[model samples]
Target chain A: MKVASGLLAFVLMFSSQAYARQTFEVDLQLEARVYTENALQSEQKDASLSLAVTPEWYRDWQGGAHSITVTPFARVDSADDERTHGDIRELHWQGVLGQWEILVGISRVFWGRTELLHLVDTINQDDALENLDGEDKLGQPMLRINYVADNGSSTRLFVLPYFRERAFPGEEGRLRPPLPVDDNDPLYQSGAEEKHVDWALRHQGWVGALDYGVAWFSGNQRDPKLVPGSVVPVMTPVGPRLQVQSLRPFYGLMDQFSVDAQYTAGDWLFKLEALWRDEFNSVATALNPAIERRDDYSAASLGFERTFYGVSGNASDIGVLAEYLWDERGDEGSGFQNDLFVGARWAANDVAGTALLAGVVVDLEEYSQFYSVEFSRRIGSASKLSVEARAFHDVPPEDRSFFLVRRDGYLQLEYNLYF
Target chain B: MNHPRRKINVLAAILLSLVAGTSLAQYDGLSAEDKGLAIAREADRRDLGWGDSSATMNMVLRNRQGDESVREMRNKALEVADDGDKSLIIFDEPRDVRGTALLTFSHRVGDDDQWLYLPALKRVKRIASSNKSGPFMGSEFAYEDISSQEVEKYTYRYLRDETLNGQDCFVIERDPVDEDSGYSRQIVWMDKAEYRVQKVEYYDRKDSHLKTLTFHDYQQYLNKHWRAQRLEMVNHQTMKSTTLTFADYTFANGFDDREFNQSGLARMR
Candidate 1:
């Protein structure tokens, strides 16, 4: 009902404008994956199919000097008698007045580097979404303002309040978790409420030929257990009873900060970033009292990339990145870990618009590796198609690998029409 | 003794004729009326050789800020039945604009019927009147300035003979008949040897100096065709200028009328 109302209001608002210039764009994707394990106890194999669609609209007024864009996106998944769907996407409007700009509504604001391999994109969404654990919350509503300085730098501030729902504690024991409420209980009169207030500041500067920035943000976290059936039993002394003793939400204030720098000179590029979080909050840690709360979590990574001209008139680019992650939650008292990855890409320079890309990623701490290969070719002036295949494996005892041994593949065909 | 005195007078007259013949190589300044007459006569000349020559021209437009942009265009044109009043221009390079055509029908006293084939639009559009005086692709050269120059299109007056860059040139002032023309009058400095324009100063309709064009690097083709390889125009009001470079010039390629038709534009590869 809310989605329908929002769509209707948007259409009416757009139709009322006298000289409105609007652009609509849509992107659709489908993927099927199969997972297998060697262990007898674990499920032999599982398959799932997913679909996602994103539609975006932009309206311009006053000769394109000022414009507003909204993207209402959705995703659906059905596998093994389980279904999930949601509508937590972008719905925002931006106004530009001279050198000042303001944005209001639910939107995804990307800051800092590592958009390709996101490690610092952890403001409003869950950690699972950042790690691509599953289809997670899409975006959050926020009010943001930006001011451009005379020296070509800009400062932005945001105020956001949003909500999300997660699996109840001990619900993994059941085939399907019970509904949050019975629909008639007085305590279940309203849905679970979680509110947050976050503030972040970022500054960008040029270090010779490289662009760099530093960002810092602090926010509040609260998740209340308002539903009676949300908590199930894991360990029962007598008969099975509700695992949750209290329905109060865990509340805390969390601060996250990071600094990053990148430079591209000639055929070589370098990137580096370091992040630190104080008093990291985790529901798993909160549920298990034996797991101590981590006071500080720090991670740092560095990457180097270089392009080589092959004798066969082909161009090849190779890059390597080394990263270290530390969390106090590790088993051996102090959490310390390191990972290294190296990748290479080759393309025929003489070809009009054709290239081949392949890479491998390795996690030293987990002793796991993933390899992928992709080929792309330009179809015409404004179209392109690509096919890719990837395989994940656990090293050391590769044959005995269980959850990490899988072949994942995807193919994408895209075309752009410009005016 | 009286006969000898008369012989001395004749001998002096002969010496004077010999000196006059030798010194006649130097250009003599023309009166205001004669200057206008010479420009009119040059415009009326039926054998400028443009109709038979395959030539490339590079035009540069410069703003007051010292920035320069260049545009190179090739022309293959031919006279129609020696009438000297009609001709067709065909462009062969710059793939997007290749096979595009332009036809000019010069008249004795009014605006010419100038038509251009737009490849993208696949149509022939008669240039609008308001755009006639505007810069051609934001260059220093206006569309009307590049069209065929006819005697009746402008009223000319010989200014004064002046030496520009050490070359003695004939300066002529011309005022366009079109009231909407951005320029009120233009002063052209023509070289004496080939009558090729060496420099031009444009005055806005308000009579304010708006721009100046300087032509250099003269290359003589086919012994009789003298063309400037570089022409730079600077807009004083806009502080902008452009430079043009010409190359790959061929003469008399037998360009046909069919190549300039609207249908030919769509068939361009």
Candidate 2:
């Protein structure tokens, strides 16, 4: 509640005092979902409804040399009590002074070119409470500087002062960890903890037909390790005592060197994202004390996308995408390692702006497939309707990751209104 | 059949002979194709140096059933030394689509380079030329149509001269040399006095009538260059049309080459 008020004040102040002006867009989304099975033994129903609202504002000033953008978002879910949330998605100021550019405040930065693997996009913490898709992110506080070279290349330096913890759903939420993640009991390897100042440097340029960006980041890991720490028996006033479980979050220091590039030639778009990361690679357990160590691993992804237009004698277009994911850890790697992803996008290009996307990620070792189908169309000039279906099939128990959410596959329908 | 009619015919025959004699003498040094090339070259020369220009435009699209929609944007163009102009368009309105900007580095040789910045994603995407024939922002104007019109892009042939809207105009048909071009040929009419394009008819790749565009309300800027205030393009097959109203024409804005590149797209607004 305090953060909400502070954001409102900031927006009102900026909008009122600026000599220039900005354009505003408001988007409201109403989502409904039906789970294939109950979240737990005590859940009454399998269907849920939710609402999400987003307002975006941006403007340029000082002869268009400077700009500021603000976007605030909030959501409320009817069935999933833990899904109700709000946050400042972005509030940043950017300005160009001669050959140097400066940016301050909260921002979100994307670096990878591939569709599935975002190896170098490590700026903001994912809002995992929303869904497994990593598109949504919470605001990150940082100060950055960019220097432009005469040869059309640029180098940017980032100084991140605050760390944002990745959000997780409650125990009652489906497709979640077996035990609740104790977000409030976060622990850190570094003494600075949440106040640790992490840093990153990136250089981007174009070479002939290909454009590439190389990035290096060293700081705390965005992913956390959940450890069962304390368990206590609570005394009840009347009948029986209840046993409660407590979990602690641990973040490790990590260093990542990554490169992402794209080559554009006519209708074909080829992209690659590769990374070498050093961190604690294994999950630590109370019984296995050797899990903590400085380990290095390598991973990469390669993909190509092609579009065919005027399909079926209409103005529609269809794009086919295929990518191969690789991880050096082999059997020790997560479910994403050694997987093949193939997808297709069908754009009707009609007045309704109808579109459909179907994709599947198949594990090479076990042949377990995570498939999804998404379709969307505009209801009018300001509103859009989207439907999505997801399924998981055929997985051995040793593929422990895929086996967890095997029954969490479901369908979702969403409507969005934009102003 | 009658004495008066014979006299009138004799007079008309003499006048026709005189007109034919003058036309033959006028083409003594050139063939029909050469004459067409010369006229196109002259038209290109006349539009050579306003140096740079910028304008705000409102585009209105209408469907076959009379449904209407609108888009607002601003365009800035810089004339390259020996190549086609570099142009950038910044969309400002309809709210949701605002802050979208497109930068194009048109060239007289090969293909034009283009980029688009999506505001919602804060990402700049390089546009491939394979879809250059696609409609721009769902308007009647295709992406290729908005690129700088270069002289080397087309081959010209002289058609004829006719009076359109009380102005004497030269009509010529030009065929695009680009293999991926959606159109087979285009016929353009230029006013003889100002060398301003007054109308154009586009032929699809199948050599079928596709669209017609008419320019109106031209005004001279800086007393040396003419800029059309209104342009209307109607698709013959779809029965849909789009009209663009241009305003706030400014020239010699001191925009450098640095401001027309892909890096400048995000700051256009």
Candidate 3:
């Protein structure tokens, strides 16, 4: 209830400010999902719902010499058999100064170039806490700065201090096994806890028609250790005692270095990237006493995009991407995973004002597939509506082998208003 | 009866020829240099008017690889004053660019002061002095390219007489005294009879071919002025081109200088 009230107040305040400005924009999204996976014991269908709202305000000043814009956003979701209320998301603020830009507060930073895959798995979110990351050792307190060069090139740097972790408040009504928590445990207290600072630097440049960038980061890592058969006395029934060791806040350096390049000529664009990281799974997994020294990982991705313009100035774009990851932490020498994805997007400026997009992703190593489709229409001068659907399934490599039936799908509806 | 009618017709024909000869004699005897000077003077006189016109501009931007992208824009302009030193221009279209205003103070043979009002930023920024040669909105038109042509801005010398587009024209070469101008000199071909600009070739500081502009589809307005409804400019180095289509000309509009002020820009919407 407090989260709901706080989110409501934030929205109202920002919305009023946006209304005062002649330039304003708002985007609202509502999503519904149905899950049918083998991980569920009862073979029952579960439904989940979520809502997100974002509002922006802009004003030009100094005789048009510069412009200022502000955006505040929030979200709410409900799941768990539709009986419990959803958690409220955090608020975020973003500002731009001429050619320079800055982003503060809590927001998702989607970097990297893997198709339907993520190479830099630095942050993990909590399942039950909609906006919070239960596994993260740091809450989202980050500062990002960027500088533009004379030749239309740019560089950016980011500094984030802390990590977030989730802990059970009590022993009753536990959804899963609780981590072993003693008085000496560093992350014993509950909810979200901050740990250490993470920093990164990136430089982007253009060589002829190709755009390229290299980024590097050093940060606090998550170290999760699994103790075999070492049950602890948490004083709870029905739930198993899982001895999960959480390493203390140690002074260590976990780094990720990457290089990305893309070239766009006419209607065709090609991109490629390679990422190297220090650990596999969670950074915490590397801290286990049994195997704490093995920490080398790498991933690479390549993609191609093309666009076709129609007679009426409308355009259609198609893109395909392939990604591969080498994880030394997997079974045998290392697990090699690959994902292939293809997408098609259409934009038309006819009377109907319609846009459509569809995509398919196939995970070759895991034998999983994901499909998505979306359509949008402009309803009025400042209003638009969109609908989207996504489906995921797991397939077995051989026909004679038994396959896990993992089916997760969702339907989303969104409305946007611009001024 | 047939003889009398024939004599009457012959006399009328002779009278009409005498009148045509007298009118033609006024301008035909002038030297080529004087003819060139006369064309420039006529342009200065007729172009000075408070008029509003709408134009559709098209630009084709080509790179070294021969790749191209085309962009189109519609413009509405009001020329408020033409005192040879100052002019005010107001544009009102392309909702994103509406409410924008420009004030230009032109000197006879010196640099011009240009101020632009951007409604989105609510600020009237004075354009830097060094950017006069930069392309206007990434188009072939440069900041210094579209200013009013004053007689003193350039020194003209008649090159020769030439047939341009099947019409006899006087080719004049003009050298600009302003050091900031992107072009050192320009060669212009004007129709001797109509005083209309048929073609112009621009030469860079190194005397290299920079661009060419061709005017066509001339229409007489108010019985005193001829305006071309279509103009095409092609940049040789960039391999880019721009086409301008003009229409809806309203002459002698009662526009005041105060209407082009910075405060007035905010109220344009």
TM-score of each: 0.48, 0.87, 0.48
Task: Score candidate 3 by TM-score against the native.
Answer: 0.48
Name the 10 consecutive residues with the lowest summed lDDT in model 3 chain A. A168-177
Q: Pick by lDDT: which candidate is best?
A: 2
**What C-alpha lDDT do the candidate models reach, one value each?**
0.52, 0.80, 0.53
In order, what fnat does every candidate score?
0.00, 0.18, 0.00
TM-score of chain B of each: 0.74, 0.88, 0.75
lDDT of 1 by residue, B1-269 (tens): 36997899778767875865322222247656666766556634523655555556665544455544334455555554444355455553222234366755555554454546653223343322233564454456776666666666677888877898889877889888777566799998886545778998999867999888888898877665776777777778766667766667666665555433322222222
Residues B1-269 of candidate 3 have per-residue lDDT tens digits of 35998899879767975865223334466776575566677666655553644444554554456554444443434553434444545543222233466766565645555556664334443433333454554456666666767777777777788998899987898877677677889999988676678999999878999889999899876676787877788889767676666666545544443334333332232
Ranking by DockQ: 2, 3, 1
**Residue B5: error of model 2 in Å?**
48
True contacts kept of 3: 0.00
In model 1 chain B, the worst 10-residue window by lDDT is B260-269
The CAPRI class of candidate 2 is acceptable
lDDT of 2 at B118: 80
Best by the DockQ measure: 2
DockQ of 2: 0.26
What are the per-residue Cα lDDT tens digits for candidate 3 across A42-143? 423355566756565555432222334445545564543222222212233444355565656553343433333444434322322231112212124567
Q: Please write out the lDDT profile of model 2 over residues A313-349, one tens digit for every residue.
A: 5567899999998888764555677889999999876
